[model samples]
Target: MNFVKRAGTSLRARKARTVVLSGIFVVICTLLLGGFLLQAAAARQEADARRTIGVDVTVRGKGLGPAVADRLGRSAPVNRYNPVLPLKAEARGAQPLESDGPKPPGTRTGDRARHFLAVSGVRDSSMLLPFSYGSARITAGRGITPEDSGGQVAVVERRLAERNSLKVGDTVRVRSADHRRTVPLTIVGVFRDPTPDPPRWTPSHELPGNTLYTPVRVAQELGSDAAAVLSEAVFRIGSPEQAERLHAEAERLLGAGTFDFRVNDRAYRDQVRPIQQVGTFAGLIVWVIALAGALILALIVMLQVRERRDELGVLLAMGEKKRKLIGQHLVEVAAVALPAVAVAALAGQLAGQELGDALLDHRQGDVTPGQRQREPVAAGTPRAAVGPPAMDIGPVVLGKVAGIGLGISLVSTAVPGIGILRLHPRSILTHNE
Candidate 1:
């Protein structure tokens, strides 16, 4: 008989062993593929979260001024520096129109009309990013420039422009609480602040309307001397370790009481800790289960070989080569294993997608009331926010799953067949006694 007939006969005679072995192969492939895919999905999510929140170091101080910014610029390995001070300003004249709506008329209308927290000596490096509202772009306008540092130019948020019916080249009036002088700011650019979530304890929710972006000089011209004291300093560092070192050095140079500085290292650690812990435990469980499956399958294959010894010996006595017999058995195992591996890989992919969605929902649900309560709004109305786009499982992940599953199945079949290679024709058939 040919290899196919031989394989069929052997498998039929060992039906119990074949069924048990196939079950074990399926279980092993399922656990390994599922664990790997889930881990990969989690890693992708963590990376995206880190990129979204990009600040490396944030420094806050009472009496910290541009001088501190200058000193840090000179001393620290800073990629960028952002100096910020919060001050109130009255909107003076006509409201700029934003995509969302028109600015409501009030004491906060026009430049002198709205209450704005002005920044003094705003630097290029300090500008916030993704400066656009839902589906809006920062077209036809220029960002805050260094030459405009001491000038009366304003880069208003897109929503602010839409509400007030303001556009590029329009001028808004601003009044300083400390000084009676009114500053007329010509609109230079319209930008967006991606995060609708404002910092804690700030009034006028929705990223603070009447907010104007002007040069540091314009801000200093509007607020008190104490206003020049930098409220916060932002830095973009090259590496996490570098950020930590800079934080420590900043504490030494600026004095701890002078400022509260934080590095992204701690936040990164906190964010990844849960995922790492769970991944570790899950990996351990998967390993244990996979090992158990391999062991069980190994035992089943060995038992099947023992029961088929007579048939194998007869084949050998008929002049069939040892390699051919081994090949036949391998092909039989693969015929059984390949389908199981395919099913396991498909199951893993489906499970990964489900797990990702569940994780996202759980995270969103955990948002505190305080956090959700303070979301930015335009005209006291909430904008329809967009959800994160769906994740695409590309060929890379699918290929990996396919490769891993096939490899596991092959190893499971091959590991216990070494004894099959040593069987002797005479020893088995003649001793069939």
Candidate 2:
């Protein structure tokens, strides 16, 4: 009989030993697979923390004005500037067609519905707070730019656009609430708000989702005489640590008479704190599992070889090559280990989620709500204010786990196999008794 065939039959015949060893392999494989998945998840979260959290400083005061916002943004360390001008308008060719919200009283069927829109004049509408928290996403066209300043262009919400049958380059005719001014707004972009109805207690602007974003210049030109009194400015910093320094510098450069200087680090902190915790926990667990898995598996394999010494001895004496005899031992362990690894992929997915969530939950309280951190957020994409949470453990993770698990098991089993397999067959047979 072939040595390999003989070894397979032996493993099947020794039910108790095979079961115990297989159980050990399953545990080791599960832990290793979970560790890899957590590590990948942690990496993705840490990488995206900054974008999901958002800008560092938000200066809101009456009449902060575009000039002031622009100047602060151009500050030595500041990367992006957002100027906000709020407007209320009765918009036509802008409201969504599907009627869901309470229509204005006395409205006839087939008539174009008008809405009380909370229009904003922002340098980049994509940088607006709605997009930061994922309440709104820009789904069509391009965002407002500096070159589009003073130009009559607008990006409307998706629901609003669909209701009115509008698309990029279409016109949205906005009339000021008082009817004193009207701007023929051209639709350059469209946005979508997934929430059909926010809580009744929520602000009107956040609920009905009738938001229109226009260039600051056009906003400034069309915004009412009192518009400047309510305008605010937002400035982006490279990291949260720079907020205070930049705030001080901005205050010194432009005296803080009209605007109240406030550092908006809470959002960045809240989103990043848990993500970072997951990363740190994964780092620690990976080293621990690697060492423990290797040591335990190697010790088990060594003991198994000692127990089966007579079998190895007889095979060696029967003219079977030592290499073939050792190969049979390896093949038996691999037979058990291969199935353990296969089963581990399923367990790892569920375990990874639990481990990450648990770690994130535990570490969340590490950083106080008001405390400052120094995480970095790359400032390149003008519109991608916040990155959505990433799912990293999929097909790629499974492939890696399988390959690494097999290699680790092989190494762990090989280390002990080598030590005892070097002994002479006659000495092995005598020691077995």
**How far off is residue 84 in model 1, in Å?**
0.8
Where does candidate 2 clash, by residue pair? 96-163, 97-163, 158-191
| Model 1 regions lying over 4 Å from their true place | 1-23, 53-56, 60-82, 86-170, 175-182, 186-217, 220-229, 235-242, 248-260, 264-270, 349-351, 359-362, 365-394, 413-415
Candidate 2 ranges with C-alpha deviation above 4 Å: 1-3, 46-49, 57-81, 84-121, 124-214, 219-233, 236-264, 349-393, 431-433
Query: Compared with the true structure, what per-residue lDDT tens digits does model 1 show for residues 158-210?
Result: 67788788889998887777558688999888765554534342333124444
lDDT of 2: 0.66
TM-score of each: 0.60, 0.56
lDDT of 2 at 112: 30
Assess the local accuracy of residue 228 in candidate 2 as a C-alpha lDDT between 0 and 100: 65
Per-residue lDDT of 235 in model 2: 70
Task: Report every candidate's CA lDDT.
Answer: 0.59, 0.66
